[model samples]
Target: MMNRRDFLKLACFSVVGTPARSVFDRLTGKDIAGPTKEGQPKWAMVVDLKMCASKPGCRDCVDACHSIHNVPAFNNPKDEVKWVWTDSYKNIFPEQSHRFVSVEVQTRPVLILCNHCENPPCVKVCPTRATFRREDGIVMMDYHRCIGCRYCMAACPYGARSFNWKDPRPFIKKIKEDFPTRTKGVVEKCSFCEERLAKGLKPACVEACTTKALTFGDLNEPNSQVRNLLASKPNIRRKAYLGTEPKVFYLE
Candidate 1:
């Protein structure tokens, strides 16, 4: 017997032919067609590891991102909900390291978040179209449409998305009224601070960094700081060989 979710999924695929507009747009109330034209401002971020390392044990970026987004602080590893956090260099860029790599570089703490890849596999695997990429290239999730199928979580190589094991509002120390708190049985992740971008402000993490290690701007703009940094610095992306084309670049 087809369950409600199964019926919806089948109905969505049935209504839309292979090449038509996303059937889930009407069904899920969100557009799945992403980045149709050229020259639109494609958002990206650059993280300078040297500068970030200068301020060792800095949690400004992580705290700022989580507070503004209303991310829960479950404190349990099993129910962790993180928008931004840190990981060791080798863990972040396993393919970029070698035996000759300096120990300092290998174990350096690097900020981690959704890379907002140009070709996001999560969007492709989301059965309910809960996850989709915007025309500006920001991968977003509609929590309401999410059926907690966990397919997107399995598809994302970066492990950026988090599944809410329980209602998250209670765990949030203080809810940001502007952002909606997510319920149990949904997936969420960094949206590249699209809300702040819409308000002509930078991402929470970038603005909160005292060392100015994080840079955010339009990747399509030749004169943008992010573009200029990428041009002048040797940068690496997490799991780039997977062909994700991650917009977040780390200058090591």
Candidate 2:
């Protein structure tokens, strides 16, 4: 990891010389912007529809994820901020759509969030290196380094990135002290609770689910819950044809 002094020297604005990086990325530290590290667990989430359907009015997963991440709610659909939310099956999986598909299946909503794609378009278009994939395959956003260019937002096909049009703190009903609240202009989204993972805990959404609707674990381990669930269920990704290789899957 680069120390503060090294980062300052590398990223600091120079009057006479060309800048090596944007003042932001350099100030925020370069290591977080780098490639995946070796031997780290690749995290993935599986949404099981059977259990999800059992809890009709349950918004526990969304609430837990947002509360823990300090995600704000502007309430307007145009400026809505959500790390996890409900989406209709047809909208999420248009490729699989067919005439007169079961009414119940069509109407049933599914959880949607960042896929944390293996080939993340958001990471590719980020000029400031604000968005990068971690060693464990979790795509992260460094809010401090973000320039709010919205290039990553345009690049993302999953509609996962949310830009704060206003300071989000005031809109947050209940704040999580340990979690950092994003300021206006930085893009934010589901991090898969990298903070909790570091402390040997599961993501808040997964832990809060009463019906065990959400399953998360390392994809590398063959016996892991995520992998086992995948093997046991015929699952589908949001856009598997695009080749982004989204880590999130849905079983309906």
Candidate 3:
């Protein structure tokens, strides 16, 4: 019984109304609601300071992590990084210029990478669920699902995520047997070797460290070695003031 113009208007309204209704539902958590499954274990890492030394050949951790992750070796800063690397204070942590006397410590190269925060701001800011918090308390990224928005990268306070500006496959030579190659225009970072962890193996970086400086275990587990180590040693997390509550701990 509707006229031509009235029918057309009704159709347009229906189309618009459907999307608006969907948006309202999403806001009410009706779109993404899900039940949390029990028995999924949470994992965390603790780095022991007393055991870690900044000597040469001590970069096994860096080498191991990079090789396993198939990270590109771009000397230029523009195209670099994936999993792990070392950075000096002058490089990673610079002193404030306004401060009269900077007490900034220039300790040996601290192996710097993702902290995998328990409550990751990066995950919350990602428009695409590319970066998400796993039930195990590890912050993970699904590069395949990522839309190259770079929102998660910017949201990260720790500078953990790296953007692949170009094709990474060409730079990687003699690819490690365990790691997979990443493509361009995606964000990547350390996943704490979830693949290895699934196999009941330690992270490549932890295994590669000759000094056994890196400790990987469940921080939630009271009887774990990392927990015991924290009890005995004086440790600090990088930028605790940020309240990221990083799983990686450093010994002073």
Full-model lDDT for every candidate: 0.88, 0.86, 0.74
lDDT of 3: 0.74
Query: Which clashing pairs does model 2 show?
Result: none
lDDT of 2 by residue, 44-130 (tens): 999998789888878998988888788888989888888999887888888888778997887688889999988787887789878
Candidate 3 residue spans exceeding 4 A from truth: 1-39, 89-105
TM-score of each: 0.86, 0.84, 0.77
List where candidate 2 sits over 4 angstroms from the true fold. 1-38
Comparing 2 and 3 on TM-score, the stronger one: 2
- For every candidate in turn, the CA RMSD to the true structure comes to 9.2, 9.7, 8.6
Q: In candidate 1, residue 1 scores what lDDT?
A: 97
Best by TM-score: 1
Cα lDDT of model 3 by residue, 1-252, tens digit: 899999999899899989988888656434332233465565767765436654554778877778778988877987776577766544444532233433344544567778887657677667888887776767888889988998877877778889999998888866776667889999999998888898999988899877777888876677888888889888777777766668887765
lDDT of 3 at 38: 68
**Candidate 1 colliding pairs:** none
TM-score sort, best first: 1, 2, 3
Better of 1 and 3 by lDDT: 1
